[model samples]
Target: MTAHSDSPPSSSSRRRTAKKKRSSTPSTKEGMPSRSPRALSTSLESIQINPRTPKTPRSNDRRWPREDDVDEVELSLLGEDERRQAADGMGLEEEMDYVSQPPKKSVSSKDKSAIVLLVILYLIQGFPLGLALGSVPFLLREHLSYSQLAIFSLASYPYSLKLLWSPIVDSYFFRSIGRRKSWILPMQLVIGTVMLLISFRAEEYMNHPAEHIYEISLAFTGLVTFSATQDIAVDGWALTLLSEENLSYASTCQTIGLNTGFFASFTVFLAFNSESFAHKWGIPRLTLGTYLQFCSLFSFGVTIWLLFKKEDKETSEEDINIKTVYKTMWNICKLKHVQILCLMHLLAKIAWAANDAATQLKMVEKGLGREDLAIAVLIDFPFQILGGYVAGRWSRGDKPLRPWMIAFGPRLVLALVATLTVFWFPKPPITIAFFAFLVIQTVLSSFAGTIQFGGIASFHTRISDPVVGGTYMTLLATFTNLGGTWPRFFVLKGVDAFSIATCNIKAAGQQLSVKAAECVSEHGKQACKDLGGECITERDGYYIVSAICMGVGTLLVVFYLIPTARKLQALPASKWRVYT
Candidate 1:
């Protein structure tokens, strides 16, 4: 009886020990528990033993796939000391990769499309400038004096002052259509309509330009004002449209497009109006009015196209008030670079101003016809385009504004050479040699000017903060325009100051028998008689003006630009902000 009772208790204790062993031995399924208290305890213990095995290794492998994979293979072959050394090597490689690898550029298709649109919009911005500024010298040469034409420059005042209201454009925008489009579309339409209205009366004005000079000036001034407003919007849109990498080309588009539009308005328009060419080609004669209407139609068509397009909503939606605009403007003005840039703008283009104002008049005075002027300008257009493209490419890489100082030397040299041409070239009935000389000079100088302008424009685009793009760019452009415009005032005054008096005998009605030449005088001044209605003036003023301007520009470049460029090179690129 004692033996039977001992066997039963021992068998029961053995069964209990087997159950405990089964629970202690880890099974794959023990980690995955199902609704049992004993299984839950086993799962908890299993998790504690290999806590990092499940997740930490997998994440590390994924994070550093190549390094980790190589590490695992090497670790298996290595002893503990070797494995530790290999791990240290792997960490060093990872750090080097992190330091050396360039950040991936993520340019999208949308960004490309936006750049194309910017090119077109910039073209449109350039379209009216040809008529307003480019064609003014040629068109007014018949009826107005050089002084009168220079005074007409007052019309461009809006371009400089547009910055005053640029804050308004930035702060308030049409949310429905887009911040840029709302202003761009309406202003474009207005400019087109104004051009059309002026076209209806353009012939009348042309026939009697003297009588309608003030009226024409007033009318064109309104057009320029509207166009300047449109420019503000377009500039702001460009800031939002392009990525930082693509900003270098912004001025390339501006230079090419603007020159193309100017060529059409100035050179092509003059060609169409050429009496000799019109007679030869048998093309139907069109008045200036018709051309204006055509431009207006084009403007309207572009406006319609803009309606179908969409812009990115990258602009900040901060509650923009007048006070905010003022504060931002103030802050922008306070930047050290901004102050220097303003002074540069005021002086940089003085040489260009003298050349631009005096070149056409000099060519005309040298007996070149309107058709000759047109052909010269046409030949110049392609070179300008080429220069802009080359400069844009040079500026696009790691180096940006440094190329401007290099281009400055060539630009100044060309201006000086062109000034000398005025004195050396003979008057009307010019030889083919003279014409060739003029063409070559025009081509070379246009190229250099375009390059210089492109660099300045790219720099402006780079520095402008996107949040206040319109105000910022417009401010820079305004200074540039002011530099270009103010010199004209001095140039025009100098033209009159240096003019030599010539007497007209035919108008005086002096008899052949008279003892002395009866010179005609009007209002206590000798009446100067020359071909093409307006009396020809000597180019002495132009030479002096160009020399002085070029000298000052050279001095500034050496003293200001060289130092500034070196300083800019030393600074980190991150210090130059594109967006606020």
Candidate 2:
């Protein structure tokens, strides 16, 4: 458990307990004090955050990572005096690598092949993301209810949760082939295989998505899971592929490649698939199946190409263990600031939940063209980059949250504007003025999201403890991503709950079955439409839910959230540290 207590024992009491516990604890063969296995077990239990049920075992081990089990972060943290003690106590005079990282290869920045390889792999990774986050949701909105879309949204969860198992992927790789390859090759192959198989019935599943929602979600979830793993491996391998001199290229490649792939799969694919666009160009519509098969082929080709590519193995021979990583993460979580920050991340998205989850779909429902929607996104990309860059610059000072808070106000305004836009949308044969307005709205929304994310992310990077390395930031990010994810289901459900609709506008004499469906349920809506009823919904639940989100969010931010965020930012450096 997290070992939290508003009335925790005083420093004197804790020191006395530690002294007593150490005296009671047994000595190792080298005469170093060893923690009980029970303490480790307790730390393991803490991973699930049962803070109220904390075990009261206050030894030095609880205060810091012990000598023998210390990880890379703690290893580097050893001072001259501490290093001598650690070296003498652990008998580590000979193995220097255990105490330090190995030197990185100094590859040139002009290493074209390596850059190309990284770009291609990242591009492959982006396809599944686009398919899940971009392509699928839009398509489903046309035929399914918000409730059904909520179910389908589960496919996006694995990306957020990937960090939980990342250490296992990091540590347990087949040395024969290579650590990165053991993960990347298998993951890519599996992702390709899944995509290839799904291609067989892509159109069928999409056309009657409600009937196969579960199956579709499962398949895509698997794809995303594998892709997430692949991403971790690729990211880790990027260090090995590029020398310190050229390491900057890796992130550039990742950005360019992933964006290009996601753009092609989502915006380009949708534009080409639009009947209006295709007919205007005198071109045949692209099939979903063809796109899936093409993506699978790209995946397969990438796997094959990587099979021959060599990687520089890390000089440190010791492997990372999953248990150790989880324990480290749990210890970080046990911190009061970390816990509060995590909770903040989880609750932060509430104000914009409806805007994020329902806005584009609402646009689609409100007579916006898929092509036009794709175009809006297409135009928004540059602004996203610009927003992030500008926010990144602004977040350099003491208070990053100021930028984040500023962005939130505009985002909330956009949320309200989004709801109004949906309400005021003109019927089919959509006007250019409306389309231009929607496009402008989308661009601004994208910019707002970028700035908020960038500013908060800068804050996370600044405050995160180096003792845990990337794991600390990764933990925060997982919760941040999760905050946006889980509430979607409820927000979607709320859409139907808060709406007022009537499906009783039936043909003159076909009134026998008008009562079968009041247009509430998906099946009922279909049934109502089949009975020749207009199924008119005078008051959309989307508007009610959005208004509630904006009001609650604005109040929460002004009266509570912004102040709480400043307090968190003002916390002393000591509180952020999880280890001594």
Candidate 3:
């Protein structure tokens, strides 16, 4: 019996010894449960954390159980937790040593080529792709019996809603030249070929003049279509070239290029055609076709030149293709700032078109013939060019205030001056009032145009949403067209068909006055009498309406754009994403 009792006590001592052995040398898997003391040590070690208190793990229920002696405790299932706590207790420097190294510089021959290609493509994009659209007003009035509204309206249609097809352009590649290049090359070639073809048939079509308006419109539609497409690709190309560091210079260059193209096409081309004494008169009917063909050929040639220059370069960002472009465009359209500007765009353009519809009519109301109007317009070209240059400089300048003043201040002041001049000087002294109005209108219009285009370009650059830049710009173009063209077409359908005098002579009793004056001053006396004799004439009510509309439109644009410009100025330039 004594032997049995001794054996039982010995066995109990052995079991205690085994337990002690297990607790002394714990494996990492078994060391996780005793977490409290280690956590306390960690809290003390970390300088960033509060040394006096342990962090609460969301709730009391989730808290580590309060133990009597964590160092002495041997937990069954909490081994992993204790190990993690121990690992965390190591010095931060050791932890940081486990972090990854920074990336190396990546430059290649291809990257260099890409930069060159981008700039060249952008520069080439500035030529006259759709000059015919600008000439539509004159084209219809000269060749077809169609009213100004119909021609402008039809011509504007292709551009007015180009956004609808922009997604397709952004998504699908033409299976030959890649996505952007595919559309660009073919369209360029087509524009050139079609312009050349149209040049041959220009006079035939004009002379036949049936419901041939549709045929002419069809031709214009093709031009506008390709032009809008080109704009999309070019815009995308521009955005791709821009970076935080060089965005200002890049944007300014783009703006200059665009305006240069616009002015060259509108002014320089006209001048080339205008040398009548050299037996090369730019008579619209004879020269329009050839000029367009030349422009188209030049534009296409440049695009092809870029094709050769950029063949080796590929976009490094996997997201540079059509799918990404569409996605980016979608996202940008949803942005609040973009939405606001778009709305303002629609509103401002409507007012602009309303006021613009009567400019030529107003001149006619002052007894000025078409030849006289043409001469006045010719003289005003330089002022317009100067205004464009000023606008470019102001927009590119650092000061928000100067740009705002150049854009809206000049526009509003000119509108007021023009209004006063017209109302106060209808028939004064050898067409003095007429010339004054012309000068003011020309200067103001040019300055206003500069502001409008530059401001829009700048705004477009700043709104760096992660949408396709090209598609976003196309939307801007589409909206601008909607704003500028639609309202004018709808409101002034018949009004622009006849000059102010021809339309209102019967209504105002000026027809009888003209016949009565035919015997006295012949044409001279009739001109004076039609000027409302000594009283201020109300013949140019349309122009007054237009000037007021312009003044109001200027106000609207200024209010909308100035705040945006200020906000853009406030943000760090580095934060801007050139490709939104």
Best TM-score among the predictions, by candidate number? 2
Best by lDDT: 2
Could you tell me the lDDT of residue 129 within candidate 1?
Answer: 66
**lDDT of each residue in 1-580, candidate 3, tens digit only:** 0000000112222233223222322112332321110000000000000001111111122222224213223322246555445436754343222232235345445444555554444334334332443333443443332243355445546545656665565444433354357667777777677777877886565444344667776776677677667655554443333331222233334334444454455445444444342254535432666766676677677766857744311122122334544455566577665676577657755445544554444444444444444455556655545654554456554553346434556555655565555455455234666576575676566557555554554444444321233344445545644665566555455343222332113335454323221111123234444654422222433454565566667666667655655665566433433231
lDDT of 1: 0.58
Better of 1 and 2 by lDDT: 2
Off by over 4 Å in 2: 1-110, 317-320, 505-529
- Candidates, ranked, lDDT: 2, 1, 3
lDDT of 2 at 93: 53
Residue-level lDDT of model 1, residues 1-580, one tens digit each, is 0000000112222233223222422222332321111100000000000000000111212232245445555565777666556657777564344334457477678677776776677566555666776665566665555556666666756655665765566545545566678779999899889889989888787756657768888887887778767766675565446554444344444444545666677778877876766887988665688888988998899899999988765322123455655665677687776777777767766655677667667666555777787888777655655675676676654456666768777777777777777777786778888888889988877676555555655665555553344446545656755666667767765654554434323435542221111111121122233311222232345566667777777887788766776576456533534332
TM-scores for candidates 1 onward, in order = 0.68, 0.80, 0.56
Off by over 4 Å in 3: 1-130, 143-146, 157-161, 174-179, 205-211, 237-261, 272-286, 296-310, 316-338, 355-409, 416-441, 452-482, 494-541, 544-580
For model 2, name the residue pairs that clash. Answer: 1-46
Ranking 2 against 3 by lDDT, winner: 2
